[model samples]
Target: MTTLSDQDRARIAAAITEAEKSTSAEIICVVTRSSSDYWAAPFLWATLVALVWPWPLISITNLTASTIYLTQLVVYAVVALALSFPSSRRMSLTPSWIRRRRARLSAREHFFTQGLHRTVNRSGVLLFVSAAERYAEIMADDSVSVKIGESAWRPILDALRGALARNQLADGVVDAITACGAILAKELPPRENDRNELPDKVIVI
Candidate 1:
C-alpha cells in the first residue's frame, strides 16, 4: 500500500469537497485510511492475544503433561480450520473461487479524486494514486468507494494531509472531512435541472 502522508490525505479530502456538484457541500459517505484499521484491527488484536496466552499455557502444561497436550492439539486444529475457511470477518483480500473475491478486484464503476482513480464494485474499492507522471494503487477489500469528483476532493485531501503532519489524523483529519464535507447524513437529491459547469472553474475558491 502507498503510505500517504497525513498532509497528502487531507488535501485529497478538501479537493473532494471542492468537486461536489453543489456549491454547498453535499455528501453522505466518506471512507479513509482509518476505516481500514477498524476492520483489520480485530484480526490483528486476536493474533496478539492468541500469541501471548498460548505460550504460558503450553509451558505450564508441559511440567504436569497430561491430557493438556491433547487439548492444545485440538485448539490448534480448530484455529487452522478457521483460518482456511471462508468467513466475512477473515480480514482477507486473497483471490478465491467465490463471488466476493472476484467482485472486489474487478469492480466496474469508477471515479477520480485528487487525481486518484477510485473504482468500486460489490466486493471492494480500489484507489489509484496519480503522482505527476507516475501512478500507484492501494487495494482494500473491506471498503466501498464513492467517487465525488476531483475538484472537491483535492482541497479536502490536502487539509487531511496537513492534519497528518501535525499528528492529528484521528482528531483533525477525520472530523474535518466528516463535518465540513458532510459525509454522514443523506445529502440533497441531485437536481435534475442543474447545469454542468467546467471542472476548472468550479473549485476556483
Candidate 2:
C-alpha cells in the first residue's frame, strides 16, 4: 500500500487552508491504497485451474475419484497461495475496465460519505486518488458546476493524471487543490461572513 509521511499530510492540510482562503467551496483531499479487494481474480484463476487438472488425470490414469478430488483441492490451494503472495500481481490479473469502474464508484461513494453534499452553499469539491488502480477524479457540487461548468475541471484532472503517472501524488494533489481554489474564487468568491462548513484536512482511507 502507498502512504504519505507526516510531513506530506501536514503539507496537504496547509495547502487546503491556503486555498480555502479565497473561495467558499470546501476542498477535501483523499488518498487510498485501492478501490476494492478484487478477490474475484484469484478465485477465478484457481477455480479454472482446479477444474481442468482433474480432467487430464481421468483420461490418462486410473486414479480413484476421491484421490483426484483431493488433488484438485490441492491444486486450487497451491495456485491461490501463489497468486496471493504479491498484491500487485493479483491486481494485474483483474481487467483494466473493472478496476477503473470500481475506482469511479469509490470516488462517488467518498463524495457523499464525507459530507461534501451537506455544505451550506452546495459548493464542496473532492479530489480523490486510488493509488493501486492509478485512478483519480475531481468531483464538485451542483452550485459550482452550474456556475463554471464541469469542463473547468479538465486542466486540474490532466495535471493530477500526469502527477500520478510519475508517482508524485502529494505534489499532484496540492497543485489540484490550488487550481480548484482559483476557479472557485473567481466564480463563487467568498460570501460575506462565509464560514467553513467542513474540516480542512487530508482524509486517508
Candidate 3:
C-alpha cells in the first residue's frame, strides 16, 4: 500500500483550506489501507488448490491414502501461508461488486465517525478513498444532497480515479476536494458564523 508522506498530507490540508474558503459545507477527506481484509478469498483459493493435489498422484503412482492426505495438507498449508501477506491477501481475484460494496459501506461509516453528518446545515461532504481496493466514494449529507444531485459528483470522482490510476493519490484527492468545494460554494454559500467543524488534515486509517 502507498503511504502518504508528510508533504502529501500538507498539500491535501492546503487544498481543503482553499476549497472551504467560499463554502459553508465542510469537507472531510479520509484514506484507508483497505476496505476489507478479504480473509476468506485466500483460504478458499488455497483449499481449492489443495483439493486437486491428489489428482496427479492418483493418475500416476499408487500412493497410500494417508500419504495423499498428508500431501494435500502440506499443499494447503503452503498455499495459505504464502497468501497471508497483506498485499497477497488482497488480490484482485475478489469480485468487483464485493470490493465496491465494502468501500461504500466504509465511506458511510466514516461519514458518521468523522462527524460529517453532524454539521449544523447538514452540508458536509466526505471524500473517502480505500487504497487497497482502488476505490473512491463521495458522500454528501442530506442538506447538500437535496440541493445537488448525485450525478454532479461523477466528474470529480472520474478525475480522482484518473489520478489514482497514475499513482498520484494526493493530487487526486486535492482535485476532488476542490471540485467538491466549488459545488458547495455555489449551493451552500459561506455563513458568517460558519466554523471549521472537522479537521482539515487528511485522515489515514
Candidate 4:
C-alpha cells in the first residue's frame, strides 16, 4: 500500500481538468489498496504446515499422543499468526484467473459507486488500479464503449502497469487518464453545455 501524497493528488486533479477540457466524458480515477484480502491461501498454507508437524514427532521423536497433539496445536497457531502479517498475507498465491476476476468485480463495483453509470451522456470512463493485485482496469460507459473497442484500452493498461511496476503509480494514472481523454475527446467531444459531472479529485481506497 502506497499512499499518494498531497502533491500527487494535486497533479492528478490537474490532469483530470486538462483531460476533460475537450471531452464530454467524465473520467474518474480510483486507486485501491487491494482487490481482495486472500485470507484463504494463507490459512490453507498454515494448516498444511501444521499437518506436517505430527509426522516428524511420530517418526523421529518418542513424544506421547497428548504432547504431540499439543505441539501440533502450537504449530498451527504460530504458523497462522505468522502468515497473517501484512507482507505474508499479500503474497500473490492466488491464481491469476482469481486475481483477474476479483479486480474486474471490484472495478464494476466502483463504476456504479463513482456514478459513472449515471453520467448525462453515458460517457463516463473509470481508470481503476488495485495495488495489491497489480491489476488495472479501464471501464467505460455504454456511449464510450460503443465507439472505442475494448482492445483499444490494452495499450493504456499496459502503460499503467509498466509505471506501477516502476513505482510510478501517480505518473501511470496521469498518463492513462490523458490517453483515455484523447480517445474520448475524439469520439465524444464536449458539448456546448457540457458540465463537469463528477469530482476531479482522485479517489483512494
Per-residue lDDT for 111-145 in model 3, tens only? Answer: 99999989888888899999877889899999899
> How far out, in Å, is residue 89 in model 4?
4.3
> RMSD for each model, in Å, please?
13.7, 1.6, 1.7, 1.8
Please give the TM-score that candidate 4 achieves against the real structure.
Answer: 0.91
**Residue 98 lDDT, candidate 3, scale 0-100:** 88
How would the candidate models be sorted by TM-score, starting from the highest? 2, 3, 4, 1
- Per-candidate total of colliding backbone pairs: 33, 0, 0, 0
Better of 1 and 3 by TM-score: 3
Clashing pairs in 3: none
- Worst 10-residue lDDT window for candidate 3 reads 84-93
Question: What TM-scores do the predictions have?
Answer: 0.25, 0.92, 0.92, 0.91
Tens-digit lDDT track of model 2 for 1-205: 4568888899899999999999888898889899988878888999999999999999999999999999999999999888875788789999999999999999999999999999988999998999888788888899887888768888888888888888898888888888888988999888899998888889998
Instruction: Give Cα-based local distance difference scores for all models.
Output: 0.36, 0.89, 0.88, 0.89
> Can you write out model 4's per-residue Cα lDDT over 1-117, one digit (the tens) per residue?
567999999999999999999899899999998888878776787789988889978999998999999999998888877777775354666677888898999999999999999
What lDDT is obtained when candidate 2 is compared to the true structure? 0.89
